[model samples]
Target: MTISERPVQSRQDYDGRSPFPGAHEHPAASRTQVGLTGAIVVLPFIALVIAILLAWGRGIAIADLLLAAALYVVTGFGVTVGFHRLLTHGSFTTRPWLRVVLGVAGSMTFQGNVIDWVATHRRHHAFTDRPGDPHSPYRYGTSLRGQLRGLAHAHLGWMFADEPTSTPRYAPDLLADPAMVRLARAFPALCAASLALPFLTGWAISGTLYGGLTGLLWAGLVRVALLQHVTWSVNSLCHVIGSRPYRTRRHDRSTNLWPLALLSFGESWHNGHHSDPTCARHGMGRGQIDPSAGLIRLFERLCWATDVRWPDPERLERRRVDVARKARAPAGD
Candidate 1:
């Protein structure tokens, strides 16, 4: 079983108290940390504004859009396939070099380093919608007012809470891997390269500094912002909205938000994923488009990935929630 598939302790519903010892939010982030997070969160919107202004002044370059699309696919997949499935969930195995490649690519997206990202996500599964979940939208309470506040918390506010997930406790395996350790330590450099690559590419291609600036705006800042929110939406919106065709653990309100499938590279099949955390494919149902899963399949075909834990039909059938029974189920907290 994957690390995430390990048995998790059950907990009572959240009742405005700590779920575990020392579970309370830490002190507010340091000024430097807050400023850094602000840059990560707010700079993209600033880039968007500049992009709009530039669009009005001179139509957005087709080259800029294309470069943005390319980087989005690369970095986005680096998270979904690399950091998430391969590293966090152990959904498949790849050769050593590809593993480091994926790790570096994901680090560029301005998410935390690979180790911290995996640790936080593993902790999320261990606690789910309960009080211990790092980013659960149900954090505040079930009331409308609480849900609103919790949504904000889950979407981005939690980053400022400074609640650290201990890497040694949650990601010991990564720490033991020299390649991952080095890659995790190089996170800042990778992020800089992530931005610089687009600018340099645009400059090289167009032979103009203006081209490079626009590339940075759209491909660098805007791409990071868009992917960040789409991933965050899986944390905040997926739990509150969307249909739940599969039964997850009690209080685990993960849901399948289709609108996010393409943008999130199929990671938004949240309910399906929560049902079988170790499965490689999140979009288990027919007609559910899952680009990440498709990419994994491609890697497997190319002999780059193996031991892929594709969904088992019989197992899925066993986990499927009967529609009639689900209708009688009480509303989620």
Candidate 2:
């Protein structure tokens, strides 16, 4: 049965409203929250160290490699295609069962509740790399030290802050959905599933408890750690290292880092995405290999997704021209 059907009881927990005049937050950061973020941030680094040690000593089995790859693909797409595209952007649609499954899988990514995910992501797009951008890789200005600090900030440090983005403005649609709301509330369980399922699969396949432990360590914890970095790289590395193929209103430097394309699904095509936010496919160009788009197309063939906003040649050409004009125009025209 679909899980998003539970009715919302009250608006007390809702934080979707734009605060009124004179209700400004005295800007602050919570040290406790920062410490928690530090823990989360450091935990992954330690996991990386452990993984490297394991690999160096050859503790990881072939089965663990296969299991890790399999889990990464699932959770990666859960965030890329399912969480970012389907739920956050509404670029296309999905069947009820698949939708619920995707939502649950994405929750296990340990990002946040689905509504919060969608809301924060939408706000990021709304003000990418700009002042209101919650996690811009260039927040601290254009000095080398600043860029380093900003990249660190953008990658995951911003999560240390306590000021939550009011979800009502960014994700009213998701908030209104009965099933999505319920699925969002199931985030804690989904996170546990993310970790436990890998161990269960490993034990069942290898018929050993040691296999299960490695699976949980590699596929469950370590995999989440790696994918989390890759996902955040769209915000940090993509901004700092890649090429900007398209234009955007936001002053943010979003690049299409080719190295990350396969790993991040089509999301490495960040410039195109920022330019055409509602388009179903981020890698709209011919050479771009977007597995997420392919999956969506598969769904379309099966009569699941509809109203896909595929790129149009005319519109793309115009967008390019507009970008050139903005770049080359006289300073005071």
Candidate 3:
């Protein structure tokens, strides 16, 4: 799972009613908890370094490279399309079986169990960059020193903090779904399978234990590390460095960082997302490649997804910064 399922109180005064459900903040994570979180963040980088060193010794296998790419696409889409778009935002409707499949695939990303993932994200939207936000890069003030520290906090530090989002308050729908509950409970097993699948496939293909080990390092650990940082960068860099083409709520600093678009499966279109959270497509502008939206379109064609929330041109036009600015200009200007 993620943090405790236990209801916890808001830690700071909010703009309105607290999004978090309970009384006082949960205690700081215990030393053992922090240690585990560190391992999750550090071990993958360690594997990446070892993989590079091993590649230097002998030319890397094509099989390992192919496996890494394949697994990365599957697991990455699992998070971007399934967890973030479908479950968290209801960007579209899908068959129950497909929902289960998507949830299972997302759980393999090791981000968190499906329930906790949905809960935490809902709370993020409810409070955004303000005080109740669980991982805003602006957690500290916007001073240069604070910005640097908050970037770290948003990128990889907040997981070690003991703050708990209330699942009942933020994600009771997921909790009520028995299939989703089972999938959430299966998170640990799904993670094991995520690592094992690559190793087993490489071993079967290459007929060697060395091949399996290499696959585990590259496709398993290294792949996880890359996805984790890319996802976290959306939380950190997307807030700090990029263009804001659409108008969002006050103090919501989400931006669209094109450099990260391809790697993030179009999730780097953060400004579009923050502006229209329920839209199936985040890449609302021309030439904004959105692989996740493409996948959703494919699902629609296959009758797997319906009621897709495609972008509304008029609504989007209204939210454009230039449009809003023009609307406020004097009639005689």
Report every candidate's CA lDDT.
0.87, 0.75, 0.85
TM-scores of all candidate predictions against the true structure: 0.93, 0.85, 0.91
**lDDT (Cα, tens digit) per residue for candidate 1, span 1-333:** 012322333456444323332334345877888999988999899999988898896898999999999999999999999999999999999999999889988999999899989999999998888866888877767778778888898899889876677787789999899888899889999999999999999898889999999999999999999999999999999988999888788788899999999999999999999999989999999999999999999999999999999999999999898999888866752
lDDT of 2 at 9: 23
The segments of candidate 3 whose C-alpha lies over 4 angstroms from its true place after superposition are: 1-27, 323-333
RMSD of each candidate relative to the true structure: 3.9, 6.9, 4.5
Q: List model 3 lDDT by residue over 149-170, tens digit each.
A: 7788889878887777888888
lDDT, model 3: 0.85
* Candidate 1 residue spans exceeding 4 A from truth: 1-26
By summed lDDT, which 10 consecutive residues of candidate 3 come out lowest? 15-24
lDDT of 1: 0.87
Model 1's C-alpha root-mean-square deviation from the true structure amounts to 3.9
Ranked by TM-score from best down, the candidates are: 1, 3, 2
| Residue 9 alpha-carbon offset, candidate 1, angstroms | 13
Clashes of each: 0, 4, 2
